[model samples]
Structures are given as C-alpha cells and as structure tokens.
Target: MEESMRECMRKLALWHTRTFKPIMTHDELEPIMATLGFLGLPPSASPGGSLAWKEYAHSSSSSSASSGGGGRARPRLPYPRIDGLHSYTYQAFVDGVSSYLEMCDISVLFHIRGMPLHRLDLYKKWRRMQEDESVFVYREGTLDQATYNLYHLHRRGGGGSNSGDGDYINVKMYYGSGDGNGSLVIRDKGNSAPVSCLVPLKDIIL
Candidate 1:
C-alpha cells in the first residue's frame, strides 16, 4: 500500500510537470487554486487573492469516524478560511476553471477581430468551430446566416428554429466586382435597418 501510494504521487508529479507546468503562467494563481481544489485539497489564503494548498490528509485521517453510533459517522472536511476567501469542491473547481478558460478563449477571438464581446452566441459558435475544423472556413465573409442561426439556437439553450428571432443577430454578405472583395451587412434584432454600413472583408480579422 505504501509503495502504491508512492507510485501514485510519482505519477501525479510527473503529470503535473509535463502537462500543467508548460501551460501555467506566472500570474495564474486562480488556475493553481482551481487545480488543487479539483484534487480535493484544501486551500489557504495568499497574497493578491491567491490560494495556497493546506496539508489536511494527516488531520483528516486522525479524526474520529464515529460518535455514539446511531449511524456510521464520517469525518468532516475542513471549512473555508475565515478571511472570506473563495473555496471550492473538486467538481465546482473543475466547472469554474472550465468556464474561465472558455471565456479567455472567447475573449482572445474577439480581440483578434477587434470585435466587441457582446454576443454570447457568437462566442459559443466560435468555440465550436475551433473544436471542429470542418465546420467553416476561418476567413472574411465566411460567417454565414446558418452559423448565426446555430449560434442563436445554442444561446437560447437549444430548442428553436433557424428563422430570424428577436434574440439573434442577422448578417448579410455582399460581394464586390473585384476578386476577394466583399462586405458584410450587420443588424441586430428589433432594429428597423442595418446598424452599420457595409464593412469591407479585408478590414475584418479571421
């Protein structure tokens, strides 16, 4: 059992060094806290809203498993620190980190295009497209109405038509006479006309 435990620790350390270390940035304390939480480890407060791991295994193992036995009692996990720090369970940590990463990726996409980060559906669609390379070409005037409709459907929590609704942004493409030249007509719902003039394809980022 001792050997097995050592092996487990060894593997975990190796995995951390190989996978986690490469991706971790110096400023990513939240991600470190999140990773510890996902491993069911306790966290103590640190500088700059960061968290540090607290060794709790010894204490947890020493706790009583039974009081007077009306039923089989279990040891209680430690509570969050008294300093009003954020604490999380394994699943909660995973969820929070996943959400944060998704938002970060979405932000990068919007930043690349110099677009405002106002549309949740658009972000979702972009993420999906990233995962599936065959979905759509990443170029100007490649964003079609179908993709927008799909984005809208997903944003509405997946139970709707492809038709225009008040919740979706509508985009139209216009091709110019010159090769590789086009413009986009963008309009939001509940608007009488296009909100902006035709934007040139070359001006947009992928």
Candidate 2:
C-alpha cells in the first residue's frame, strides 16, 4: 500500500510539472518553477518551448570570467510562494487526477492525507443536504498564524488583541452553501464576532 501510494504521488507530481507548467503564464508559473529548480529538477519549458536556464548560465559564466576565471557562481533561484491559486481548487485538481490514475474514489486522497473518518463521513452527508441550509462544525485550537493572517486581511479592519495563552483560535467549515463553495470561519474563543476566512481546503486537514 505504501509503495502504491508513493507511485500515485510521483505520477501526480509529474503531471503537475508537465501539464500546468507549459500553460501557466510567467507570473503564475514563477513560484512553481522556482520550487522545482530548488529541488534539483529542470524548470518547465515556456509556452514557446524556451527555458531561462541558458540565460542564467550565461550570466553566471560572465560573472566568473570577470572575477578572473574563478568557478562560476550559482544563480540565486526565486523562492516559491503560495499566493496565486486557491488552495482548495489546486488540491481538488490534484486529488481528482490522482484518483483517476489510481482507479480509486476521491475520498481515498482525503483518507491518505490523515483526515478523520468521521469528518469525511460528515462531509459526505452534508453534500446531500439542502442548498440554503448547512452544517457548521469545528475543532478548537486549530488556527495557524498564517491562516489567521488570511482571516485578518479578509476582515479588513481590526483591533483584536493577540493572545499568548498558548490557545489558538477555532477553525470552522460551513457546508451546503448555495454556491457549494463552503467557507472557513475563524474566531477567538473570547470574542463573539467571527471572521469568514478563505483557507485552502488542504489546510483544513480534517
């Protein structure tokens, strides 16, 4: 089972590199390509079938020659940032493709990711409910700082005090919305007002 899972992940990674890399615009692909390069893999070719490696190599050689033929300095690669795509959408795409290749249900991806069996069951149940009405359930102390920042930014104005009590905020998910794009809600235990945060589906972890 472990070996099979690894193979699925490998195929998924390769598909992401080959399929999305060529089509994404420079601004969209920059971070992903940088991550691939940092992992000692070749960055994807551009839509025109050209890679920037030649230019980078040329600049490195020129710098080495100018410094009296010392060994060429490595070019600095850009760091990957998660800002362009919606997390849930990306994960769903990956899960869908992987499910197709593995000949398994999408829930298998969630199971492999360590999501609780009960939460999975609950989500499945929620899918069959009415569109306007929904269920909200949450786990306490699950809010990470990065995700909190996303919530904070979405709220726009804030004067909420930060707590250092080692107690993190609650993370909630709303299901059965009209659009079916459920929301992530965050709130301090002491505060009655909660902020609706847009978090990546994978980040929910349960």
Candidate 3:
C-alpha cells in the first residue's frame, strides 16, 4: 500500500510536469471571473454611495451558511489573485481542457464551445482518469462556438495545488463572446501557456 501510494504520487507529479504548461495571464483572468460572477461585488452607485451594501449581502449569505441552517449558500471559492481579462483564441481553449482535468482534486463541470460533455460515458471516463492519474487528454468532437451546448469540467476542491508546489497551480475560467460559444480557460497556476477553449454561451449555467 505504501509503495502504491508512492507510485501514485510520483505519477501524479510527473503527469503534472508534462501536461501542465503555462497558459493565460493575470490580465485575462479578471474578465473571466467577472463574467462568472466570482469577483466580489463591483462598485455600486446607491444612496449609501459605498460598496458596503454589497458586502452586507455577501456577509449575510456567509453567515447563514455558517449557522448550518441548510440555506443554499454560494461557497467561497478561490479565484485568481491577478487582475485582468484572459485573451486567447478558440484553439488554445481546446488544448487547455486536458490540463484542466489534471489540476482538479474535485470535479468541475464546465461548458465551452457548445459541447457540453455531460454524457455518462464522458463524465465516467473523466472521473476514472482523474482518480489514477494527472495528465490532460482529449477525444475528438465537433466543437464549434455555435449550435452546440458547450461542455466543461470544473474542480470542486478549492483551487489550490495538490503537490504543495508554489511554482504552479491549476486554474479554470469562463469568457463571454458575442457568438453562441463562450470561453473556458485551463492553464498553469501562474497563468502561462494556457489552453483556452470556446463553449456555446447558452450552455453555461449562468
């Protein structure tokens, strides 16, 4: 068992090194977060004239969640610390999906380029691959930014490194284009050489 654990860890590390490449940028991350509504409340103009009202609502929700009253509260999820929008072409998005999967400890359901990958076979294989390894792989599909319900994979675990390596962490994001497809980014923790994929905007949960 010890040996097996070591092997898994070793493979995981190796896989991360090979599959995880630098993609995306701090500037690019901001817009994606904003579009996804992950960034805390933006400035609001009101009689109070302060962001306090936004915080109040956020705090209320958090407090309710803490009390365990079974309120469906949005958990505080980790997002990029950097500021700005992630700009990448659609091709980049597709390549990045494989890397995105390896970085997740928890499952992430993402929609991109009008190809929602919710089928039982896809999800099952994704979970299975994730449990035993850490490399990105892709299967060919007719992914267009239009006329398709984009697919996605999100990490349920708070976004962080599994290896405790400060150099890199796995990250994901969503982008909005006027086209039917939105954008999804999966790249290194440092936002280098990211693989950006497009998804049909209609497929996004929001």
Candidate 1: residue 157 lDDT (0-100) = 58
Off by over 4 Å in 3: 1-126, 129-168, 180-183, 191-206
Mind sharing the TM-score for model 3? 0.19
lDDT string, candidate 2, 1-206, tens digits: 83332222100011132232221233443344344231122333323433222112222234324221144223222122211222232233333233223323222222111111232332221120112211221222222234446434533443221210111124322222332222334444567565544443234323
Residue lDDT tens for model 3, 1-206: 73343222211111112233221232343334344333343322334332111111122234323221233222221122111111121222322332222233211333221212223323321211122243222222212222122222211242222211111124343323322222234454465565544232222222
Q: In model 2, which residue pairs have backbone atoms overlapping below 3 Å?
A: none
Candidate 2 total steric clashes: 0
Best by TM-score: 3
Clashing pairs in 1: none
Return the lDDT, model 2, position 34.
45
Better of 1 and 2 by lDDT: 2
> How would the candidate models be sorted by lDDT, starting from the highest?
2, 3, 1
Top candidate, metric lDDT: 2
- Ranked by TM-score, the better of candidates 2 and 3 is 3
Per-residue lDDT of 1-206 in model 1, one digit per residue for the tens? 73332222100000122232311122233344344332223344433433343322212223232221233122111133211111112112222332323332221111011112222323221211222222221222223343345444443553222211111123332222222112234545468465645432223223
Sequence-dependent TM-score of model 1: 0.16
Reference-based lDDT, residue 33, model 3: 33
lDDT on C-alpha atoms for all candidate structures? 0.25, 0.27, 0.26
Candidate 1 deviation (Cα RMSD): 21.5
